[model samples]
Target: MEILGLACAAVLLFGAVLSIETRISRSDRQLARVERKLDLLLEHMGLQEHDPRLREVIELLRNGKKLYAIKRYRELTGAGLKEAKEAVERLG
Candidate 1:
C-alpha cells in the first residue's frame, strides 16, 4: 500500500511539473507575439527609429538592388519576407 501511494505521488508531481512547463511555454509564445505586434505598431507610427542596419539596405536600394535590400533587411531584422519587402518599400 505504501509503495502504491509513493508511485501515485510521483506521478502527480510529474504531471504538475509538466503542466507548469506547458503553461510557461505558452505564455512565452504569447508574450513574443505581443512584442512583435507592438514593434509593428511603433514602426507604423514612425515612433521607432530606423535600425542602423537599414542604412545598408537603403544603400542597396540606391544601387538598384531592391531584392538584395530586402534580403539584407530580413537577415538583419529576422523579419519575414513580406515584412522585409514592406520595410524596403518604405525606405523608398
Candidate 2:
C-alpha cells in the first residue's frame, strides 16, 4: 500500500510538471506573437528603430539595388533569405 501511494504521488508530480511545461511553451508562443505584432505596429508608425538594417535596406531599394538590400538585410538581421526579400519588398 505504501509503494502504491508513492507511485501515485510520482505520477501526479510528473503530470503536474508536464502541465507546467506545456503552459510555459504556450505562453512563450503567445509572447512571440505579441512581440511580432508590436514590432509591426512600431514599424508602421515609424516610431521606433527596431533594426539598424532598415535604413540601409530602404536606401538600397531607393538606389534600385533590391538584391543588395535583401542581402544586407539578411546579413544584419540573420533572417532567412526569403524573409529578407519579403521584408525589403514590403518596405516599398
lDDT leader:
1
lDDT of 2: 0.82
lDDT of 1 by residue, 37-70 (tens): 8878987888865677689899999999999999
Q: Which stretches of candidate 1 lie over 4 Å from their true place?
A: 49-92
How many clashes does the backbone of model 2 have?
A: 0
Instruction: Please give each candidate's TM-score.
Output: 0.51, 0.52
Estimate every model's Cα lDDT from 0 to 1. 0.86, 0.82
lDDT by residue for model 2 over 6-92, one digit each (tens)?
999999999999999999999967876786688699879887554654888889999999999999898888876766776777776
Range of the 10 consecutive residues with the lowest summed lDDT in candidate 2: 46-55
Please give the distance, in angstroms, between residue 17's alpha carbon in candidate 2 and its true position after superposition: 0.8
